[model samples]
Target: MTDALSDLARAHGVATAYTTDRGHRVDVTPDTLVAVLAACGVDAGTERAARAALEAHRSERAARLLPPCVLVRVPVGDGSGGRGASDRRAGRRGGPQDPGGTDTTPPLYLPEHTHAAVQLEHGGTVPLSPGLPPGHHTLHVRTPDGRQACAPLLAVPERLPAPARRTWGFLVQLYSVLSRRSWGMGDLGDLAELASWSGRELGAGFVQLGPLHAVEPGALPDPSPYRPSSRRFADPMHVRVEAVPEYAYLDASARPAVERLVERARQLNDSVLSGSSLIDREAVLDLKRRALRAVHDVPLSPGRAAAFAAYTEREGQGLTDHATWCALADVYGGAWRSWPAELRDPRSPAVARAREELAEAVDHHRWLAWITDEQLAAAQAAAVGAGMPVGLVHDLAVGVAPEGADAWALQRCLATGMSVGAPPDDFNPRGQDWGQPPWRPDALAAEGYRPFAELLRAGLRHAGALRVDHVMGLSRLWWVPEGRPPTEGTYVGYDRDAMLGVLALEAYRAGAGVIGEDLGTVEDGMREELAARGMLGTSVQRFEYLGGSTGRHGPLPPDQWRADCLATLTTHDLPTTAAWLSGEHVELRARLGLLTRPEAAEKAAAAAERDGWLAELARLGLLPDPGGEVAALHRFLRLTPARMLGVWLPDATGDRRPQNLPGTATVHPNWRLPVADARGRPVPLEELPRTALLRTLADVFADLEEESPHDPHDTDRAPDDTTENANANETEERHGRPGSC
Candidate 1:
């Protein structure tokens, strides 16, 4: 451990905080042996054999950095190196779970060769069993007999199957869909009217929408839908432009000036649905860019101009260098990294003489990505014709805006001097960054994983379930780089077996279901290798916790969850759910001074405002106890059972507020506001089930009648490309009814 204290514990990037004078933490997280024996001036009792060689170089660096150590390349046995020192001391005294007593030299086992408890092995790459069935097999590691190790192709596990019960669902976010004919943002015709009102009314097995890619459209743009401008296209301000069927053959006397600009954009979406407020996305992209340039001057069909010139020649040259940098930012403007160097080369000849002096601004950004892919295939065919069963779900985001247009057309598989983020912990005690830019995991596995599998096959072609965001970035990603300070940054490891084998071969070729926003601070066994590959694991009911092994708690139920998850309570960067039951995120984090300790943040905000009014009087049974205040926090957040939940439509109308607020984005106003409606105002999704803030959020999911994991696409899409029309207000007589605490 003295290569200058293992290079000062690999320069402060592994601190799990040790030091009761060393080697005894069964509970891991001893801030990397007390910040590497407090940076080599040594202690841990005279560096207990340099803290047992810094716990055998952090147990051979968490078994060469964990995640079923990619099944230790299950190439059975080729002792290029591993399993030598006396059968790694007899599987380190035969594994009864080595509670930080420390081991692993030439060893790796889970339930022996993986049901994924944990393994980390790095190079010589073998790890077969993703459900194995490829070809030859065998991977024994020790007890002599000349050593067995063989492998041919490996991927057999019943030949990459699962994740396709119509790719599980539900995960909202497209600027919290302010619908009812949205123009003030929220489009693709209000995500095809919330997938035809979540498939008829909620048998909704799918509909996850956030990052409809394409952004930097201005009028207060940067509302951060993961800073786009071409994640292979879409964000034509969520194009609806009078629900373009080429605006019903225009020119009927130029249709009463586009019917008085669609009745002045339906009186500005009825003043943002009677002042629930905010919606003005540059006055709905200046009235749908004057109704899609007056219905693109009425002519296209020569087979829609050869399918928009074969989608501009199969989106060649990164959508023709981002439609020639939005036609040289409409006449040499908006920072093409501050243009003029051959107008920032989108294939220069001065960006092809500014695309032949702006061919109507590159045909209005290629007819705004063909009317945002014809309103995202008519909002996933109105969420599978509105009977529902997994209709939309899209998200994706995690990194993109180093001067957008997918960081200037995938700047050669990006990473330009780093910038991902998050390190200072105990939940952001400062460390955050998120300036966007990462992805050079060896130039996305030397582009074999074709630009992250063609941006996960263009968000599963109009998706019916995707979500991802930071699904622990497939496994490891802190990065930082660009002039450091996300606590001087580190953790870079990616290739989680070619990022979950390019997300199980693009959700098994785009039928679509993936999820992953696996919440914050994840490290140990990455939720058991994304639950042994069926990939679904986010919990959220305000961070559940009854202390581990998933039980003794309430919200932790739903069959200890992971059957390919979506389960929710609140996300779009937390807080809503009426500001987590009204202490208004503890008085907006103590009025943004972000409480360090003004008397333990005012006694943990007066005991979390008296346990949220005794969990709302134990959900109105008028609590035999909790008298002073503790409103049965939604009867203890609808007593667990989470396979899916996510109510946060501004916390189903109570709307306390918190789209985002990491570390004072200039005293806040982050992602600018708007989902309101119960007097705070902004409500729109066509006046939420005729408001009372969506009938007190459909009487709190009709008194938690359960069933919302929104099943179907647990990871690889297509349940029946949205089997169309069903939600005749479904909750099947208010959730599978059974009742209890």
Candidate 2:
């Protein structure tokens, strides 16, 4: 690649080369760089054009007095301890000077005699002061030339709030955990029940749920929550019609039709619970839509009507745009790009007219959104009311489907000819194309990150904690050009400081914790950065190992685990503990041709890993016999310094299937399996408390709680002492083999 092209790409935050997971350096092709730059609205078709673009970019930056956005870190100490305002001004252009004239702090960059002011997000305006509170505000600047400019100013806290103490919770795939009362799949009501029961009865601190983002509506709804129609709204399919307060007010004449739908739902539930059928989301949504339409016919009470009106007003144009997209999709298939030119643009007059023509349909969709919001709020309230310190932790998918609502509605902000995906590495030699459109970095900043902020606010509204899937996307994303293989993709950088500032601001405002899924191929120092920002990371037990031989690889010592994490036995993308222990995942992978190597080789590797873990368990004195592996694993997790530990609900019930198997979309039933017992019979939520296996697992956690009480001053205990004491207690208990805890 020419130096000019490389410089242009760098100016636009596109990396020319990157190191893969295996430590090999790969340089992005010149053609790929030009294509990506074009997608970002930069003209770099030739060497001359590239040089011109680079020069223009540099000129723009040099001419601007203020950046497009500014992030100001709040001072750490009280006003009395820091330098006085006059002293701070003296160091405005140079380093701060101490009484002895030594440079004490880094140089401040604000220009001299430049008028600066800030307009707070809530109400008042104030001069840019040292002690200003943390918020999303606007900064106004007047240069010496009398030229004025405004930028989005973020006054961010040094770190987010941490959990008061070590806590435990159930990590759930919400749709898979069905109940006898659900309409074919688990709904918000089931979520509430699980949260309340786990919090009140089992003392769980939270119920982490899968992404509830709205899926594309069609005859066969997309079952993957990661590729959603709109991240700003919840999926109505997860709403329980009967749980809606208005359902009780349905007229006598509508009761028969509702009963018929209820019967259909019961049959659907039976098919799934019997373990003979997979979750049919399309059928489930069809039945729920019919019933919801019937309920919509009933007039709302005065109080309910007012509440609905208030919600509509608060949501404003965003809700209207989402509902309008749904209405249009119903008319012209799900993919908006295939629609007639007149109706393709969301802001076009033709599309506006079409929305008016389908006003009733739009209103119905809007009502669905409102009801879903209500149920989500209720579920979070139930969690906290049942004594959970952190309630519902909602998952936020990295991007939206290219043909979905957000893509059509925010077309200007999404890249036109690029897809977000991962580059080829050791594990996935073929890489992956997620088929989701990435946000145009330039457009995002130009829009002041309004769309991103709105999505975050929506997700955090009813959540006590929020988990950002692929959290590394906040700093950079792999952008694959249209028609190119994922291996040809290159990394595109984003404004990390601004993105994290907005996230921390919203999370702080909501008084919630943030957990970043920093599991796979994270960049160096990313984990430390997340920890420093008070955002927890995810750690899975099986992958946490020390260097050693195949059959003897040592499990990472419990005390070595980071305390700022939500450690788990496994994640939805991986196999359950039972499956892993039994080598079921390897067998299934072989059957589906998903194994890149020979079946024997894969099985041998899996067996060696399992054996090593078992050895570690025995060394800790946590294993009395082979039958106690599950209990022993839980005991091992409890010993970790992780602030929060997550119990995979299916693991407790001895489920032997993964919720999702990455790479194979059609060959394996991903995201469709129900939570089942050892015999593979689906277990409903109501039956969980009564199950002996679940009760035993819960007791394991209870035993650990009894052994270790909260000690605020005990944060710095020696790792060796802690591990030794835990092992000693386990050895003592193993003498008599206490019944399951």
Candidate 3:
């Protein structure tokens, strides 16, 4: 690539080259860089154009006194360097303090003699003070030329708030955890009941749930939660119809229709719970939408009307745009790009007229959003009120679907002709295209990260903690251009400092912990940066192996695990413990033609891995037998000094099926299977606690809690170096006796 092109790309925070997961160096093609630049509105069609754009970018940067946004890390001194007491106790370290302690926080990079003042989010406009309080502010700058400019100024706390204690929770796929009350899949009511039972009865600290972001409300709703319509709003499909208070106020005439809808819902719920079918999200939502429309017809009470108005006022334009988009989609079809030219522009006069014409439909969507928000809030309240410290930790998807509401509404901020995805790795050599649009780094900065900030704030509103799916996107994302394979994609960089600052600012305000899913070939220094900001990293037991490819494979000793993490045995994309031990995942992969190697070879490799883990469990005196390894696995997680540990809800019941298969979309039942038992019978939320298998797992966690009643974060545990040698020997023995299984 030419120096001019490189400079242009760098100016827009587009990466020119990146190291692959396999330690191979891959350079971004000049064409790819140019395409990405064009998406950012830079004309880099030729070498001359690139040079001109590069020169202009440099001149603009040099002349500007302040960036579009200025993030100032404030030292609140509430103990964890402004992160509060919970963080300090949880072993979260803050950023480096300045020498002499005058102002430890790093200074904002403003031009010399810039004469800057800050307008706080609350009310006052203060001249740049040494010790500014933590909040979002507006920075006004005056250059030497008398030119004035304003930028969004975020005064963020030094670190994020952490958990008060080392806690254990159940990691759940909410839609899979159905109850008799649910139509087909689980709803917010089921979530509340589950949280109440787990927290008050089982002494659990939190219940981590899958993303509930709005999916495309089309003929066939996408089952995957990771690809959502809008990250800023909850999916109305997850709302329990009866849970809405307005349902009670329905007129006598509407009661018969509701009763008929209830009967259909009962049949759907029974079909799913009976293990006769998968959780049909489209069917469930279709039924619920009709029922909800009937309920929406009932006039709101005076108090309810005021509450609804208050919600709309607080949500502001973002909510308005979302509802408008939904209404437009209803008329023009789901893909806004295919709509009439005038209607494609969200701000166009034609679109404004359409909004007026479809005002009722828009209001209906707004009402659905309000009701969903209320239920989600109730679920969080239930968890906290039931004695849980962290309450509910909601998951945030990495990006929005290309044809979804967010993409249509925020088209300017999202890159065109690019999809976010992963490059080739050991698991998926063909690479993976998620079909989600990448956020244009330049556009985001130009908008002062408003969209990103709003999304974070919404996710954290009713959450005690937020799990960011593919958190690496905060720093960089793999952008695969249209018509290109994932392998042809290149990494695009984001201003991590600015992004992290906004995240910390919002999280601090909400007093919620942040867990970054920092798995799969994370860049160097990323983990340290996340830890410094008090964001927890995710650690899965299967992925926490030492020297596997070198023929010396074993689980990393739990004591050696990082303290600042949420340890788990598996994730939604991975198989449950039973499947892994039984080699069900391998067989399923083979059956679906997902396995790259021969079936026997894959099975052999899987068996060797399982044997190594079991041997380690035996060496630690935790595994009494092969059948008890599941319990031993939970015990092993407790042995880790991680701040939080999560038990896969299915693992407790010995479910063999994985909730989702990463590579396969339709060949396998991805994101549709309900939480089931050893016999493959779906287990409803109401029956979960009553099951002997779940109760046994709960007892194991409870027993561990009693034995170590004090904060587990305070407990010191040394790494077991001998375990590696033992695991190596076991690997050798297993290879010698291939028939051991």
Candidate 4:
């Protein structure tokens, strides 16, 4: 790349070159850099254009008296002044601070006799210097040179509060775990029951679920939860039909139609459980929508009507735009880009007229959003009430679908012609195009990050904690220009201080913990910065290797695990423990043409990795027999210092199939299978209490409670209600024991 182009790219926070995970350097082509710059609304097509853009950027910076925003990290205190006593505890004390409780940055460039003060968010004003409380405020400055400037100032907590003790929980893909009362898939009602039983009976401390964000409505919608239509709202399809309060008040005229819909939903559930059909999301959604329409027709009491009105008012314009998009989608389609030219812009006069024409439909979608929010709040309440310290840890998807609600509603904040993706890596030599647009850094700063702040606020509203997918995006993201290959993408950076400041402030206000999925292709110091904010990192068992350059690439020892992390045996995207032990995943991959290596070589490598863990477990005296391997692996997790441990829900029952297989879409049933046992028999929620495999695995993690006993309410052990070895024998008969490799 030419020097002029590189300078222009740097001015826009776009990288002309980057170092790969391997120890190699690759320079981005000049053409790629220009295209990416154009996506950021810069003109850099030629050397002359690039030089002009650079001059403009410099001139703009010199003319401005203050930056678009300022991030202030406050000091720790004892609840009276700053972060309080809880913030100084074991896992929460690494925030950026000097002796004076402020970060080290160059002094501001202003004329002499400059006056500065902060306009508090609520009411009054205070001096900009000295200690400022942790909240959002506005900074005002006036200089003797007759210049005045104002910007948004964010004063955030030094560190978030951590759990008082070590805790364990179940990690699940909610749609796969069904109950008898579910309408062909899991719902909020099922989540409540799962959390209540696990916390009260098995001593589990949390229930971390996959993202519940809304998906686009259509005859055939994308099934992956990671590519949501809107992250700000919960999916109404997950709402339990019977749990809505209005269901009980339905008039006689509306009763028979609802009854018929419920009966058909039961048939769908039975079909999935019997292995005759995969979970049909579209069909289930269709049934629920019809039944909900009947319930919506029921008259609400005065108090309930007032409550709904309050919710709509609090949500404000964001909710209205989302509901308007939904109403438009019903007439057109979910892809807003293809709508009529006049209606594409959300603020156009045509849209306002359309909203009036379809007022009832807009209200229906708004009502759906409100009802789903109520159910989510109820789920969190149920978990906390059942004695969980950290209940309902929710996941946040990295980005929304390009044709989805968020992309349409917030077009000004997103890059127009660039797709968020990854560069070429070892796992994917051709690289990957995720088909999601990234947030424009310049726009985020210009708007004072209101869109980003609102997104975080909504996610933490009903969560005890929130897990961020691809946390590395807070610093930088790869931008692939439209109609270009992923191999030609360049990295674009963001203001990390501002991004993290907004997150910390919002999470602090909600009293919620934060966890980041920093698993792959992470930048230097990203994990450390997250730790400084008291955010936990994720550690998967199979990916934790001991040595990098010493040629001793074995499984990391349990004792060497990091303390501030959520440790797990496997994740939804990877193979199950049982599949790993039996070499079934390798065979499945080979058959599906997803294997990059020879089948024999892949199998042999997988075996070596599995054996390494087995030897470690045996050495630690955690495994005694082949039948106990699954439990032993979980026992290995408990031996680590990780504060939070997550057991994949499918592992408890010896389910071998992954909920999602990343490479294949239609070839494999992704995100559509119900949770089943080793023999592929569906395991209902009510039946879980009597499963021997689940009971054995629970005992392994529950061993910690014997000494410390985190809960003081119970002094006696509950009677064993599980079946006596029958479930284990049946599993062994079908697939051999989990570890009998």
Clash count for each candidate, listed in order shown: 95, 0, 1, 1
TM-score of 3: 0.91
lDDT per residue (tens digit) for residues 1-741 in model 1: 234344334322222322111123222223333432332233343445555656665565464322221222211122212221121221111111111112222343323332211111222333333323222223334223333332112121211233323222345566556666665556777767766764556444566666778766554445556666566677676777767767788988788897888788887776666664555566777787777778888887688788778877765656667777776766655556776676654655666776787887787787777668767877887777775545676777776777766776676666665666655543443456677766654345434446666677777776755767667655555555565466655454454544664565566456555667765555556555665555666665555433321211222332333344555566666666655555567677777777766845665754664464455445556465332112234333334334444555666556667766554546765555667743577766766666544443333444233334333334574322111111110111110000000
For candidate 2, lDDT tens digit of each residue in 1-741? 999998888777788888775657899999999999999999999999999999998898767666565666563332212221221231121111121112222333456778887888898988777666777677777768688888776676667756766778899988899999987789999999999998888888899998999989886434677888899999999998899888998889998999999999999998998887999899898999999999998898899899999999999889999999999999888899999999889899998999999999999998999999999999999999998879899999988888889999999999999998877755566666777898887777666677888899899999999999888777778888999998898888776655776787788778888998865555545666677677888777866754311112467777766677888998888888999999998999888887788999999989988998888888988888433788789889888778888999999899998888775566777788889998889999989999877777777676333333222225586445432222222111000000000
Error of 3 at 44 (Å): 1.1
Name model 4 segments beyond 4 Å from true.
Answer: 76-110, 548-552, 625-627, 703-741
True-vs-predicted CA distance for residue 688, candidate 2, Å: 0.5
Root mean square deviation (Cα) for candidate 4: 8.3
Q: Of the candidates numbered 1 and 2, which has the greater TM-score value?
A: 2
Cα lDDT over the full model 4: 0.79
Global lDDT of each candidate = 0.53, 0.78, 0.78, 0.79
TM-score of 4: 0.91
Higher TM-score: candidate 1 or 3? 3
- If both were scored by lDDT, which would come out higher, candidate 1 or candidate 2? 2
For all predictions, the C-alpha RMSD in Å is 25.0, 7.3, 6.3, 8.3
Q: Stretches of candidate 3 above 4 Å error?
A: 82-114, 143-145, 547-552, 625-627, 703-741
Error (Å) of candidate 3 at residue 147 is 3.6
